[model samples]
Target: MKEDINNDRILLERLKNGDISCFEILYSKYSGKLYNYVLNISKGDFYLAEEIVQNVFVRIWEIHRHIETEGSFGSFVYTVGKNMFLNVIKNRMQEYLYHDYIIEHASELDNTVEKEVEYKMLEEQINKLIEQLPPARRKVYILSRVKHLPNKEIAALLDISENTVESQLTKATRFMRENLSPYCEIIALGLFQFYVS
Candidate 1:
């Protein structure tokens, strides 16, 4: 294990020097373990956890050229991964609290029956917007986002490539933006606040 760690450090140096093969080697070595770690902590919210993992890798790759050795590369990567996971959890919790606030205050309206009816109507509209997506894209979105499957698992379940699953999600998001413009705008604003602050 000590020798392996030394080799990994060398590979990380090569990766920092823009060696694609070294980067691939590091990815192949660690992706599964890191995915499982994130998945475990996320408690089945695999889609979000997967996004966190991707962000961690992207950040590492972007800053690799500047990351002078102050510690083990593995430890640095794991620290990045942990921080990303914490951010995701914090953002999700805030979103949950906001949704709860909306629901609670909505229930306190004087015209409770009317408010309920309006809420149901809005929910129906959102469902309609989702339905407007292409069949495959809709399925992928539902399974990955709603069902909370990781991309690899989603690919296996849908008999498609992980890249295809990602592509479908991108299309699904575009469709949602076009069809549910108002809701998309609101969500985008909320997400900006969630991440930027």
Candidate 2:
């Protein structure tokens, strides 16, 4: 264990110096263990586990210069991986809950002509933004959000992996959010009206 710690310190030092070989070495040492750790937490969801592991390593690589070599890199890896998984779970749950809320309370929304016009305008703006996405991403976004398809269904329908579907949805939604956030109220109204309609 002491030898392993020394090796990790040396590897981390090289990693900080932009050594891809040392980075690969560290990845090899921890990826399987991290995958298993994440796998158990995901309740055997292989795709989520794989996604979390890859994201954790990518994040580590992104901020390698500031990594603390004297500390336990294993613990760091697990901590980062766990946090990433939790964030993914949190985001998924929020989306699911938001969808459920729209379904359950959609009819309760005020049905005024002014509100209908506002929702239509916002919906048109959102549609225009979505049209700016790359073709594959646009298709995925439409299938997932507009058509109310699940990731697995979208993947099967498009002959792509769930990871691809998830990635496309992430990028698509991020693009939408960045472009439309200033009109957040209108967008919310659009989404609520969209579902209710």
Candidate 1 stretches with Cα past 4 Å from truth are 1-6, 107-197
Give each model's whole-structure lDDT: 0.67, 0.77
**Candidate number with greatest lDDT:** 2
Q: What is the TM-score of each candidate against the true structure?
A: 0.49, 0.56
Error of 2 at 123 (Å): 14
Residue 88 local lDDT, model 2: 75
lDDT of 2 by residue, 1-197 (tens): 34644488888998989988888888989999999999998999999989888987887787687677777889989977886776578568767876786687778655657667877777788889988999999999887677555575466557788999989888888888787767677656436334212
Error of 2 at 117 (Å): 10
- Which runs in model 2 stand beyond 4 Å of their true positions? 1-6, 108-197
Give me the displacement of residue 96 in model 1, in angstroms. Answer: 1.2
Supply the TM-score for candidate 1. Answer: 0.49
